[model samples]
Target: MDIRQYLDSTYLKTAQQAGLSDAENVEVVKAAVAEAIEENFKLIMIRPDMVAIAKQMINDAKSHVLVGTVIDFPEGKSPLEEKLAEAEKAIAEGADDLDFVIDYTAFKAGNIAEVKQQVVACTRLGRKHGKIVKWIIETAALDDHEIVQLSALIKNCVITHLCEDDYNHVFVKSSTGFYKTENGKPNGATVAAIKLMLENSFPLPVKASGGVRSYEEAVEMIQLGVKRIGTSSAKAIAAGEAASGGY
Candidate 1:
């Protein structure tokens, strides 16, 4: 299969987490953008701050590779205004796709309305701007039942508030690859978790992120009906080598 088209070659790291200066972090993002261009990957997912430089580089290269960024990030506790402001800034910086982390904590607390509101607001912002928006539900933080329920919740919001044809403009993504799990549990995308998402969020598409390394794993996700795989190991997978979990 032409897996590059299904890959969102990604590198979303904070300056501190990566243990690098801000400038150094940009360098890493730049290198990833260069690699995406070389590999002809579908999109390059990076931090919002890197959007401008990545946009410039992608434009200069005259490449069709999309520039995407995270919103509300690993934590989805940001107020609506803050998330909207962050998303606007990224779009203005030339982002083509936005991955939004929904308020799962609220959902778990039985605040169904609040969770739906978050999805509606974020999806509306991205759709209005003609940008793709994927909701990161952070599967690691939830059990299977929560995954199905939330996935269905997101799909319902997308279908109800947005036109049915706008499904491709949005997605129900699996994880952030950053949520810590107790007892060393799987923190990213898993086959079972993804299967639950796919079953509930059909027609909305799905982006599998976190813990996916190597060609076999990536292919498995793709074959299971995911439209995208977010990984820092894109190059290794494409080279037919095992990923070192660089994501």
Candidate 2:
């Protein structure tokens, strides 16, 4: 199934988060960019600060790989204005896609209007700049019911105001690959959760992210109608080997 085009080769760890020096972080982003180009992966998702370097590297190599950045990433509790500003900066720096962390906490707290508004505002910004907007619902932090509910909410919000052309650009991504959960608990995209999201978010595509680390898992995800697979293990997966380190 040509899973390479469905993969978003991702490396979103910051220097501080990875416990590496700043220079090393830059090198990491550069390496991921190079791998994406060589492997013919779908997109390169990096931190916003490193978007320019990734863009330059992909451009210098004359590759058409799309560059993407995360907005209010990992945590989705940021104020709407702050996320908007972050999106603007990423777009200005050549990010073709923006993975936004939506405030599902607010939604679970009965703040549906606030959550919907945030989605509306962020999608508008992406549409205005002609960039794809993917909302990370952090499914690991929610139960099956919550996942289904949130997927429906995002679908409804995008359809109500966003143009038809932009509908395909907007997606319901499963995780940030960074959310924390209880000990011995799964903290990223899982097949059952992804299936639930796919079953619920009609027309709006789904991206299965996080713990997917092999060719088999990726193919399984593709079979479930997942439009994209987000993983740091994209290189190893494509090579038909297991990725040792977790994302």
Candidate 3:
């Protein structure tokens, strides 16, 4: 199926999370960027701090792999100004895509106005800078109804506040690949959740991320109408092997 084009090979672990020293963790990110270039994946998703290094590596290799970085990362609790500043820094560092974690906690808490403001401001910044923007809604942290509402919320915000052309550049991504669920539940993209996102966020595109570890799973998400699949197992999935990992 030539799945490489649909994959955003990702590595977002911090040194502490990976149980490695700072230098060792950077090595991990370097290896991932190297692998993405070698495998010809569509993009390499890394932390904001790693964006410049990854960009340098890709440029030196003369590869086409775009560099993507997370904004406010796995936690989307940052204030609006902070999120904007982080994203601006990432853009200056040569990131091609900006994946912002939407303030799902605030949304769940009924602070819809604040959430909308962040979405509009961040999406506008990305569009202005000519970067692809994706909003990570952290679906696992939300119920089914919240998923639909949040997806629709992003769509409406884009369509109403931004131009029609921005729809293609912005996406409603499924997760941050870091949410913890109760009772051992799946913490990433599920078919039902992806479906809800796709149905509600139509025309804006959906990215099924988190916990997608196999070729079969990636294909399933594609069939359900996702534009991209974010996973740490992109290489294995591309080879038609089942990958074992959390992200």
Candidate 4:
């Protein structure tokens, strides 16, 4: 497949977490988004704290950029109502899209009903507000069966809601930067989950995140059928930096 064409359709996220709060972190993120947008990127995702600043940047830019933010972010341990409220607030604040993490604990504990309920609640709010929702499955922590089961549930939800199959409504994503393997290599299980979603006909996109810090890795994921690439190192990779280098 043509990589550039796929890149044109993919959403690139400039993620900021509790770390990287240095004086230059925000500036770097802004510059990355600006550069990515200039390079023809269609979507940019930022943290809730940086949403206002990101909004200002997007407003001042000459190009059109879709802004997104994470709700209940890297962890989905937050209460269901709280997550929904956060999604509502993000949409109200000019966030065109919202990416929410699935409750890993709930899923691991076999509380599949609760996990599905949370995803449904958040997606419902997103739809009501005319905003797009990307359900982050956090694939790093799930086994093959769990991944398949969640994919099926998401597909069922999308069909029940009558949403488009390519609606960007739900995404199976990798790690949240918390866990890693013994060798420190970023796990690629999420890629497998994404393939599962595609094979199962889930009505959503797939986003690969966590240790994706290079253009080659980004392209690899894209070649594997991911439609979105989430990273804080977009600028570095676009500039041809190696994945091992700091963002």
Among the numbered candidates, top TM-score falls to: 3
Where does candidate 4 have its weakest 10-residue lDDT segment? 4-13
Residue 139 error for model 4, in Å?
Answer: 1.5
Kindly list the per-residue Cα lDDT of model 1 for residues 68-169, writing each as its tens digit: 999999889888888999999999999999999998999899999988888999889999999999999999999889999999999999989999778987
Q: Which residue pairs overlap in candidate 1's backbone? A: none
Tens digits of per-residue lDDT for model 2, 1-247 = 6778999999988899989999988998899999999998999999999999999999999998999999998888999999999999999999999999999789889899999999999999999999989999999889899999999999999999888888899999999978878886778788899999998888899989899999998998998899998999998988888897676
The CA lDDT of each predicted structure is 0.92, 0.91, 0.95, 0.66
For model 1, state the Cα shift of residue 7 in Å.
0.6
TM-score of each: 0.98, 0.98, 0.99, 0.81
lDDT of 3 by residue, 71-177 (tens): 99888999999999999999999999999999999999999999999999999999999999999999989999999999999999999999998899999999998
Q: lDDT of candidate 4?
A: 0.66
In candidate 2 the C-alpha lDDT for residue 39 amounts to: 90
Model 3 residue 180 CA deviation (Å) reads 1.1
- The TM-score, computed over Cα atoms with residue i paired to residue i, of candidate 3 is 0.99
C-alpha lDDT of candidate 2 relative to the true structure: 0.91
Q: How many clashes would you count in candidate 4?
A: 0
* RMSD each, Å: 0.8, 0.9, 0.7, 3.7
Residue 95's lDDT in candidate 1:
98
Model 1 residue runs over 4 Å out of place are: none
Between 2 and 3, whose lDDT is larger?
A: 3
Sequence-dependent TM-score of model 2: 0.98
Clashing pairs in model 3, backbone N/Cα/C closer than 3 A: none
